[model samples]
Target: MNSKMLQRQLKKLNLNPEEGPVNKKEWQDLIKLIDVTYNEYENHLYRSHNTLNVATDELQRLYTELEAKSSQKIQVLDSKLQNIMSMAPCIIMWLDNQGYIEGCNDYFRQLLNFNESLDNKKITLSDLDLHTLQVRAEEFIKSNLQQTSFTKQIANYYFKMTLNKMVGQNKISILGFDVTEDFNKQNTINQIQAKAVQSSKLAVLGELAAGVAHEINNPLMILTSVAFVVQKHIEQNKFDQLPEKLEKIQSTITRISRIVNGLRTYARDGENDPMMPVNIADVILESLELCVESIRYQNIEITFDNQMTIPAIVSCRDTQISQVILNLISNAKDAVLPLKEKWIKVILRQVEKNVVLEVMDSGSGISLDIREQIFQPFFTTKDVGNGTGLGLSISNEIIKTHYGRLFVDHNHPNTCFTIELPLA
Candidate 1:
């Protein structure tokens, strides 16, 4: 039905557009129009619904395609990263929080002597333990996890490692760099320094050799006189006093033997000398014996005051300790030789848990500015060609190695160098 026909029928039936129809023709036409309109609206709605369905299907297909591409890209990136880690020269590995080995790179596998066939295998920290390679894997992990980055020495090799905390995972990435060659080179330098210090000691002993020979001469003369007296006693048949003379000669010989032994020990060079309990007083006395001849010749009077009757024992290398004392005494002699009244005083005493030895000299005390620099290597106040300037420096190092201290005493009127060693 058309709009004109529907309007005329409604008007003839006296029906308002807003109210119900009265005429039968009006009602029939209205009903027909309603049916036709309903059919057209339904057709339009069905077309719109079909369009929406097509759009929804296309969107779902595009989302699935994008998701697949993203997963592929992620896999490729992961493969590239794994290849880079494998090709790296230094050791790299991923470890779980519980010290389990999650994955390791090629360098790390080679370091542990593992083949590439075990690349997919799950290896843990405990699997690395062996009798030949004593690795405390738990401690290693603990140290690294605690520090985040540190250097570790396993067997003879040194490795510097850095740790990275993983996101959303209970694991750490460990990156290692080998440093054994550099470490060995540093060790070689230290050995050379030790040898140089030993050589310096031998040079000082050479300078005192003449004085030592003179010291030996006095005992030789005493023995000669005692031999003559013994011969005279035998000729006169005076056996009662003969034993006394012989005892005196024996004592002199013993004294000479001790001096020679001390020199021999001081001159010997080796790395096998183990630390032991040493008598500080005896070390001082022996040192004095080595320097006495040179000191007396230079008009320097040296005195040793050991107050304790019992030995002041300390844990140290005996000869190295003696070397330090001799070096101090030699330096004192050089310092006070120009003074009018020259004297070197050595005092040995116990202070609490320490054994202290002070070597005091009459020279003008070291200046305030230079005292701090005196222990520095190659620092010297002596004229050119007179000193190597390493004696005090080496002595300081030796004392430090023994867990002792060598320092200058400023309270004394004279130049006093004090050495304090822990009591044994």
Candidate 2:
């Protein structure tokens, strides 16, 4: 039935081109008239199929050309609308009174992982709701007005679900953003903050330990001095019997003193070191010392190639710089641990009034697509509990403050981070 109707519609369209679009208030009405005329002609399609004179055929041809031009004009308007909808960044979807995804844009399909060849008439939001998305949609549609819009966690991240009712059509359209990265980042930040507080508490305990160590050092020194004096007197032949005991006491005191001092020395750095002319080489060495345990634990061998003279330095915050180095080395260690060959290199070079500290490792390098976005705050490739994405961003910010630059080096083998600091 529709085929016969289609043939008549084509015939009418073929003839109508000879006639032009009648000027009117709006072009839509004229276009509709042309379509309705075709539909009517389709009713009598078989009766007059291919039965026309040369003059009638000529008239039909003229009408067909005019109609084709008119149709083209109408299509241009539709194309404009489609272009707008399809190119939109926001997912735009439409549904009838029945909560189905009747029409959707390219962005909308991508958001839902909908097929590229998805058609407007065939699919619905409910159809594509593989992960209980349909259930959420149903809940939204069931409600008259959902002011308290909430979030949905799918896979490892969160997405905000919003629904808006089409006022006239009694349909609903939803707009959504994949808040997975943002949500995960926020949670990590919270965890980091909590960890920092805990670390501060531990640091305070370390400070107390330092005080205890300081207190013990004085008595330890006095005992050692007295024991040494007694040992010397005994050895001079006045008290041979007591000399052996005196020597042992002095040895015990010295041992205790060493333990006390070591406790203070290994604390989490006193405070952020004041800005100074810090030797870049010295910082690198100290950072190596700081990360030695971690590096060994990960079994990642490190080679430090310092091409910079110890005299080559930069004026910057020493502790922050140290933290930056620590973070970078830690990142490299973590990255290289999974690889078959565990090797990390800390290469420092003095080039053109600047010092560059490069941490290169035989590790899984970053993907090319995401390489540019790696420096963004709260960006990470590590799993949930492994890393707090802030390391590179914080390092970048610290370097920037000192007129330095920190960036990933992709041209080299494996993963690399290069920090360049201006000497002056």
Candidate 3:
């Protein structure tokens, strides 16, 4: 969806924004959207810089190129500003400290609605003030110089005025920038850094969980085996009086074992790299087998569509890919809560040179606004303490390590998350 449409939808949802911090948050949300849509621009910034802070010739060249682009944008804005001057509905002016019209853009001239060009090129801030009514014009002028930046109602339009001390001289350069498009083109890269930090913490937690699971699995296995034997003895009429209790014990042990194992792998960092020309179909089947028991327990139907006859271009760590797939599948299952429609589709296809594996749920589709932020670590849509929000982010990183792609699709009624790998 376009920004305007999204904004209108937000308004309809009564997400009517307030000023100050609330407004900042709204802009931050928009900034995330911009990042997703403008990933290539960011990648350019990265590939052009010395990320390690080591100044290199390539970095310098990239920096120069970026500088050139910024200047180019500025020049375009400058020309557009002139055209807008006459067209603006407000009284706009570029004034000197001595209260003379240093210049006026088109918006200023156009507002007069007069083709008769005023020969007055020497109009100043004071002249505009007289036309603006001086009941508080003196205070406005004084405050304008004092504040360095502000917005005020002038001629029924919002005028955001800013003052800068022209370098090399002690004169103020006052100008107005149209907040129309917001021009919030600031490239805030800290999101990725924040994500990396969150992922690292989650990795640490996963590692601890893995160790605990491994340590307890053996004991749990032994206990579960003994419990089954006892349950069998009860079934054989050896302990018919305690049959119910034995069954309960057996069931509890199995549940705990599964939960423990779940925690262990959740924290893994793909410690081993074992790869071969493995059949991706086999991997998909194994992933399903790993989750089928849980899905069956919840009465959820599973669909596996593997139409990809083409082989993958690269061999990746199977366990790692499985972990990523399992994470996505788990999320899909959890999303279809309380709904009668309990179907999940796992589709694998070869699109050109890439292998695409998609897990689509029958739940409500994801919102476009949060879709980009979904892969951001620690930025979960789940309730507080319910999710660490690192699953997709870490999964994305894992895919990146393997030189693949990960994304969520909201183009359909069901939400689809896809992972693409290069064909080997």
Candidate 4:
């Protein structure tokens, strides 16, 4: 019942469509076979179309499933990120170009005592009641700087705030770290250091007590001699010599007064003194007055070379600066006292924008191995019971606090220590 069979029948009869058939039953059978063959072709086309439709539906279903899974995964990842940001210890805030608070982490909200939900409110920096922070942010936005950092105090706590501008965007991000504990610890350390400085001053005074007594005794003896001469002149009616003798007594008393005043000034606590502009040379000379007698008593030749033609002014606490100088000179005296040369030279000069002071002793330089350890606390080359070993270390710290430097001058031939402070 296929096309081949139909064709064979037509050929057997040798008939054409335009001519009549010779046998009617054979022609009728041929027509029925043709219909069956056409129906079979149509059924094949229908089956192929149904299979294609089924494949398309399966592909669409698979795409939908993949899309759902991907969306779920993305949601989970976003949730994790949010949780992490919320739980972070530091404060984080995002701001718009206009300085309005766009968003913030949970810590930021908690720090500002923001009880209301962020989603329900449009917050700005002004609403936080921190005027300093608001002003700083406004200033930063107006500035050409890309980022800024500063410390801010809130209640009893301190925060180190860092603000970064977003490149190619009108936004800024602020990060705040709590530094209260560090601040308190530093304050306590400063207090202890101050006490130590005071204690060192007292110890130095104690060592110089005998020399100070001798210095005062000389002036007193001169005063007593002058008084006796004045009394004899009065008894003998010799008024002409009285004026000269009285002048000598006045000068001696003045010397004693200077010594007493210098001692009084050096002995008290100066850590809390206000910083003022002072001529550094004057401070050095004043410090020398307190210890010059002691150095002389040891028969050490001390010389000062003042090369600075003009006054070298600096902003500092004079007492503390003087303490550092005296300590250095005292150390220099000790270093060279036993040496054959037995001399200490102090040089003051200006180098560029800094005032440099050098204390050199006529001793062989400190050993290379111990030079590095000299400035460390409790590290000393002096024999036991003779030194606290905190002198150089404290002096170094004091100079650093003044934004200056204290170190050994390796270039010098002998043992030399240098202090370099910026000119105010």
- What do the candidate models score in CA lDDT, each in turn? 0.81, 0.68, 0.64, 0.85
**Predicted candidate 1 versus true structure: per-residue lDDT over 16-54, tens digit per residue:** 667765777667877887677677778889999999999
Candidate 4 ranges with C-alpha deviation above 4 Å: 1-78, 117-126, 220-250, 268-275, 350-354, 401-405, 410-413, 422-424
Candidate 2 or 4, higher lDDT? 4
**What is the model-wide C-alpha lDDT for candidate 4?**
0.85
Worst 10 residues of 3 by lDDT: 180-189
lDDT of 4 by residue, 225-247 (tens): 88998999999999999889989
- From the highest TM-score down, the ranking of the candidates is 1, 4, 2, 3
Q: Which stretches of candidate 3 lie over 4 Å from their true place?
A: 1-268, 271-276, 310-313
10 residues in a row with least lDDT, candidate 1 = 129-138
List the candidate 2 regions with Cα displacement exceeding 4 Å: 1-274
Q: Candidate 1 clashing pairs?
A: none
Name the top TM-score candidate.
Answer: 1
Question: What TM-score fits each model?
Answer: 0.73, 0.40, 0.39, 0.72
> By lDDT, highest first, what's the ranking?
4, 1, 2, 3
Per-residue CA lDDT of model 3 for 210-301, tens digit only, reads: 43454456457766776777778767978754666566666666656655554444445453556555667666765565566557567888
Weakest lDDT window of 10 consecutive positions for candidate 2: 200-209
Task: Report lDDT (Cα) of residue 389, candidate 2.
Answer: 73
TM-score of 3: 0.39
Query: 70, model 3: CA deviation in Å?
Result: 44
